[model samples]
Target: MRYGIVGTGMMGGEHIRNIRLLDDVSITAIADPVESSLDWAAQSLGDQQPARFRSAEELAEKGEVDAVIVASPNFTHRAVLEPLFDRGLAILCEKPLATTIADADWIVERAARNPAPFWTGMEYRYMPPVARFIADVHGGRIGALKMLSMREHRFPFLVKVGDWNRFSRNSGGTMVEKCCHFFDLMRLIVGAEAERVYCSGGIDVNHLDERYDGETPDILDNSYTVVDFANGVRAMLDLCMFADGAEHQEEIAAVGDAARLDVLVPPGDLVFSPRVGFGAPKQVVREHVAVDDMAMEAGSHHGATFYQHAAFARAVRGEGPVEVTAEDGRRAVLIGAAAEISAREKRAVEMRELDTTG
Candidate 1:
């Protein structure tokens, strides 16, 4: 299958390398406005170099690829996507599908008319340990979920080719860019749509010196958001971008009436404990996932990224259903967008207050 990759940044470049590992899958074309990025991609592909286009639209118009893997910036998905929906091509679009509900709405509207084979790139679901935890919740291992929480203590954002990432406006705020993965997982594990969000945090550190001449410097470095699902469940997300060398890069826990599941990272694994407050004694079940010890520090061990791509490739080949739907992609963005607003205004934002339908 021929795969055209847009945006040869870190994530895009990762897809190019990992996808080529699959049999019969070829990196057919690449698109990125930055010449250096294109050069980086071309140099890596060597004799197997694919066709290059400066813009995604040009690649789409050229008709050289069977499927497209859109790892473009958060705000650029729609531009690359709107042109290809009616072409009946399969697409694996990266997160925050449109960066905002309005853009997401636009993409969905156009995408619906074509019945294109579409998949959202949400790699967290493919994480072995996280997937197991989700399965345990859905399988009734944790009855009637009540609360969920996740924490991400990692290094500052990776530098993008353009400094577009330093601005929340361009990157759709820090939550939309970084924490949407956790939000998506929370939604999946909770099995409900978020009805409201209350957030608090600030642009305390990280990019204080990043006063880009033409842009407003308003990106956040830390945040804590509480999400209330429509089903009466609650989830909290704590994000700290300055925790450079924390022992655990991420962690999560799900608490239900009957049991609880706790997950820890950098050796991401799970522990399930059944029978809480009512019982004095508890049985703890642990799922020990053999995660890479240096996954986070080395910043290159994204097994989930690889696994998710395999799933997308299968879907592109009409061999399976998309693991993450466009709606799922949009909802994740909506939650992040709302959380950002709530954080800024210091008020709870409801789904009704947002233009989710548009």
Candidate 2:
């Protein structure tokens, strides 16, 4: 399948690399507002040269590709979606479908109206360890999951090409921008929608002194949120941006009435064995699955990003189903957006109260 890549930033570059590894999938075109970015792509893409465009509109007008991979910033998803609407193009858009519920609904409406092959980049579900966790949870390895938690202890946010990520309006608040992966997986694993959220965090030490000439520093560097699910299962997120180069970048696990599961993704290997107990604490036992050498990270999802693209490619080729449907992406945004609201208003925000639905 021929692909047109929008936004030649870090994500765009990573997608290009993973796509090059696949058979019958090739990068035919690339689009970005910055000319320097296209130059970077030209040098980075080695032997394969793709047609360059200044915008998604230009690429869409050309109509030369079979699919479009949108790796642009969060707020620009709607702009990218506009020109491609009704074109019956297969699209794999990045997460937080849009910065706002209204915009997310707009994308959903068009998908419902025209019915094309479309999906979002909630790539965590495709991770071998994460998928295993979900399977183990539902397969009764961890009988009746009660609570889930995820922690991301990493360095400060990476600098974007345009610095648009510094402001809330442009990046849809940092949680929606960064933590939506965990949020989406939380929902999928627990098998329920988030009923409410309570978040406490601010631009505390990491980027507190940062400022542009005109823009305010609104993105938070740390956030702690407790999301209550409709099924009475609870999930929590502990995000700290100042602890870069710490022991591990991410740690996630779930606890059930009968047993528990944990995952840790370091740089070189995904060393995480599921320890489940059928009875008391003394009966805890470890599963003997061999560890996978994940020795790579594409935009911080670790080895899962490549798997995400593979799934998208399969779906685009009519060989598989679209797993990260539009609603899945929207619900994740809804939960993240609510977390933002909870932080701002200093109160628990009900998911249903927001102008969003999944």
Candidate 3:
């Protein structure tokens, strides 16, 4: 399969690297306004050099590609996708669909009409351990899950091409920008839509001393968000951007009537605790999920990006279904936008208040 990548930044580089690991595939074209970024993609390409363009429009119009990966900045998602959608090429746009509901909805509308596959790049679901945990929960091992929680304690956001992520306007706030993965997982595991959202977050630590053109960064460094699902399942997220010292960068737990299940990254272990008597012998089981060495090295997402690319390739080849759709992307943004509103207003926000139908 021939591929074209838009926005050759850090993530664009990651995608190029993983695509190289797949069979019968090559990045035949790449587009990015930044000459340095284009050079980076060229260096990553090594022996094979694909056609290069300065914009998505030129790539769609002139480049020879059967698929495109939109790894552009958050705020530019909608605009970058317009020409690509017009071309009807298979696309794997990265997470958080858009910075706002309106733009996300727009992408959803266009994606539904496009003939080619439209996949949302949500790699969290494909992480081996997390994938196994999700299957166990869905297979009734958790016994009708009642509550779910996710925690991401990691370093602050890294430097982007132009510091575009330092502001809420560009990166969609921390809730929509970084936390959308957890929210998307919540929806997937709960099997229900969110009814309300409450979040308490702020830029307490990271980027406080940083400035761009005399303007301070306004993105959140930590937050505690609670979501109520329509199926009566409650989910919570604890995010701390200043906790890089923590052992695990991401952790997720699911509790039901029978027992509680937990998954931890880094070591990639799945822990299961079945309910015993009040004082009976305690029993706990831990299983390690291993990822391929090359896959693990392809990206920083614990081998998720590699697996996700494989699945996307299947859908592109008509061998499997599109696991993550544009609607899935929009739903994640809906809940995230609600969280942003709740954190700013210091109150809970109802999902219906967002009017996602637009």
Candidate 4:
């Protein structure tokens, strides 16, 4: 399948590398406003260099591509996607499909009615350990899930895309920008739909002089959220973007009837243990099973990206299941939107009542 890439940023570059690894896929075209980014990709790919364009609309209009990967800025998603949707081309869009619920709903509704496939770039679902853990949980190894906890703490925004990510209007704040992964993962593990959400956060640190359309930054850098699912499951999400020393930390813990499971992303460890209770005059039983070294090699941080692309390619070729679907993407965005509303209103936001069916 021929693939076209829009937005030559960090995630876009990762997609390029991943596309290179697939035998059936070729990146036919790339579009970015930045000349240097387009030039850099052309130089790196050599004979496989893609046709570079100045805008996503140009690529969608003129490029001979079967699929388009939208890795552009958060706010530009709808603009880029609307044109492609008209072409009836398959799309792999980055997470938080859009900055607002209305835009997300539009994309979801359009894709559902369109003939071509629409996939979201929620790559965390394709992670090796996460995939395995989900399988085990579904297979009843962990029994009925009860609670979930996820944390993501990374260093300050020193990277190039860091500036754009600091604003809520641009990046959808910390909850949508960063914690969407956790929210989606929580949904995947619990096998439930979030019924309500409550969040508390603010721009406590990382006070960079970043502005969106000349407005002061409104995105939160630190956040904590509680999500209640319809299946009687609960999830807590903790996110911080200004950790001084920590390089990166991501983990998800789920408590079940038979065992407790913890998935640590950095180390790629899925530790399982039987539930044990200690009493004043009783011995403690130790039952822990650790599945370590489950992630791809250290340099291959784009494993899930590669896997997701391959899955989409196969699906286009009339193959097996696609990793993440448009409906899944819509739910992720809905959860994030609910969290944002909860944070703003200082109250729990109900999920199902929201007009997301569009």
Candidate 5:
């Protein structure tokens, strides 16, 4: 299969590298407005030459590709996807499907009518340990799950092509920008839709002294968001973008009546703690999940990009189902939109308030 990458930035280059690892697949084309990004993609492509275009429109018109991966900036997703959708090409759009709910709703509507497969790229779901954790939770390892909490203590956002991510207007706020991955995971693990969202976040640490055109960055660096799912499942996210010194960049825990399950990303350990009476012998088991060396080397996402691409390839070949659909992307964006509103308004926002389906 031949693939075309819409944005040739860091994530786009990651996709190119991992796609090269897939059998019988090649990155046939790439498009980006910035020349430096195009050069970066070229470097990643090595000797394999793919047709290069300056814009998605140009690529859609001139490039020959079986499927397209939209890794463009958050604000430009809807615009970049237009021509590709019109061409009836299979698409794997990166998450927070769109910066706003209206655009996400439009994408959902269009995707439902398209004949080709539409995939939302939620890479975290494919992480080996996280995938196992999700399966174990659903397999009744954690019986009657009561609470879910996630923490991402990582460095600040890296430099994009044009500093497009420093502002909420372009990146969809920190909640929708970075937290969408966690929100998506929360929904997937809990197997329920979010009913309400409450968040307290602000631009506390990162990018304080940075200025673009005399305007300081407005994106939040830390946050605490609570999501109330329809099935009475409550999830909380504790995000600290300034805590790069921490040992684990991401950690997730799910507690139930029976026990609690936890997964740490770096070492990729799954810990199971069963309910034991006080003073009883504690039996806490820790198992390490391993990822393919090549897949791990290909990207920073702990081989998730490779696994997600593998699944996407199967979907394109009619060998498997599209695991993450346009609706899934929309729902994730809805929860994120609510979180952003809640943080700004200092109140809990009901899911119905942002229900674009109606």
Candidate 6:
């Protein structure tokens, strides 16, 4: 597979590194407005430098690549994807799909109508731990599903990726820009559509003028959301990038009637607690059963990126379902957008109100 990448920023660079590791796929072209970014990518990939284009249009018209990976800013996703769709090229787009519901809907509609495969960069779905957790839940290791709680905490944005992400108009706030990953995870764990969402957030940190230029930072720096799923499952997400000294922390805990499963981190430690009952005033019996010892392996964020790219490549070859479909991406955006609306309005917002049909 010959792959072309748009936007050579952090995510784009990660994609380049991962694609280089794959056996059959080659990054044939790269598109970025910044000359420095293109030069850096070309230099990093040894002698087999990818063709560089100044814009998505130029790349789509001249690159003649088999697949295009859109890792540009949030607002540029639709613009990059439209040309790729017209050219009948498979695509692997970064999360959040687009900054707005209408734009996201357009991409979803295109994917439904087009023959070329479209995959979203919700790479967490490929993590071995997460995958195993999903399987266990589906296998009924945990009784009836109850709730999901996840927290993604980290330091403030440090990497300089243009000025688009600092403002909500460009990135659709931090919730939509960053929390889409958590929202997507919640959806996967709940296995149900989000019925309602209530949120609260504020830009209490990272209030630097350089970050937002003269424009006010409308994007929240800290956010909390409660999502109600249609299957009587509730999910709570806490996303805060302003936490001091915290590199990153991610955990997903699922509560069930008989057993509880918790994925501690990227390595995804699964702890199962079977329900135990004791007689009140009579007698107590203890059962000695050895706990399952599944060795957890640390995961490379870059490896997850490579895994996602490989899945996209395989899907293009008509192998299997996309790791993360276009509809999945749209749902993530819808959840995040609804959370933002809820935060702004100080009330719970129905997810259906933000759905495509609405």
Error of 2 at 238 (Å): 0.7
List residue ranges in candidate 2 displaced over 4 A.
Answer: 267-300, 356-358
Residue 133 accuracy (lDDT) in model 5: 96
RMSD of 2: 2.7
What is the overall TM-score of model 1 with all chains considered together? 0.93
lDDT tens digits, residue span 1-358, model 5: 9999999998998999999999999888999999999998998788998999999999999999989999999999999999999999999999889999999999999999888999999999999999999999999998999999999999999999889999999999999989899999999999999999999998887999999999999998999999999999999999999998999999999999999999999989999999998999999999999999999999999999999999999999999999999999989898888989998899999999989565
Q: Note each model's CA RMSD in angstroms.
A: 2.4, 2.7, 0.8, 3.3, 0.8, 4.5
For residues 1-358, what per-residue lDDT tens digits would candidate 4 score against the true structure?
Answer: 8989998877787888777777867889999988888887787678987788999889988898999999998888999998899889888899878877788778878988768888888888877667777787888877888888888787664454446765778877667776777788888888888998999987777755756577666777788999999899999998887865564477677788877877766666777777656543433233322332322321145257666666888877778666677777778878888888888889899886675463
Over the stretch 247-294, how does candidate 3's per-residue lDDT look in tens digits?
A: 999999999999999999988999999999799997999999999999
Question: Estimated TM-score per prediction?
Answer: 0.93, 0.92, 0.99, 0.90, 0.99, 0.90
As for lDDT, the candidate ahead, 2 or 3, is 3
TM-score of 2: 0.92
Candidate 4 vs candidate 6: the lDDT winner is 6
Pitting candidate 5 against candidate 6, the one with the higher lDDT is: 5
In candidate 1, stretches whose alpha carbon ends up further than 4 angstroms from where it belongs are 214-216, 276-282, 291-301, 356-358
Clashes of each: 0, 1, 0, 0, 0, 0
Model 1 residue pairs with clashes? none
Candidate 5 residue 251 Cα shift, in angstroms, is 0.6
**lDDT of all predictions:** 0.82, 0.81, 0.95, 0.78, 0.94, 0.80
How well is each residue in 1-358 modelled by candidate 6, as lDDT tens digits? 8989999887787788777766787788999999998988788778887888999999999996998889898898998898888898889999879989999999999988777888888977766566667778878877988978888776776555676777788897787888998899888878888999999987776755553445666678888899999999999988887775554366677788867777655334666766666643433222222211321111235145656766777888898777788999999999999988998889999977888565
Sequence-dependent TM-score of model 6: 0.90
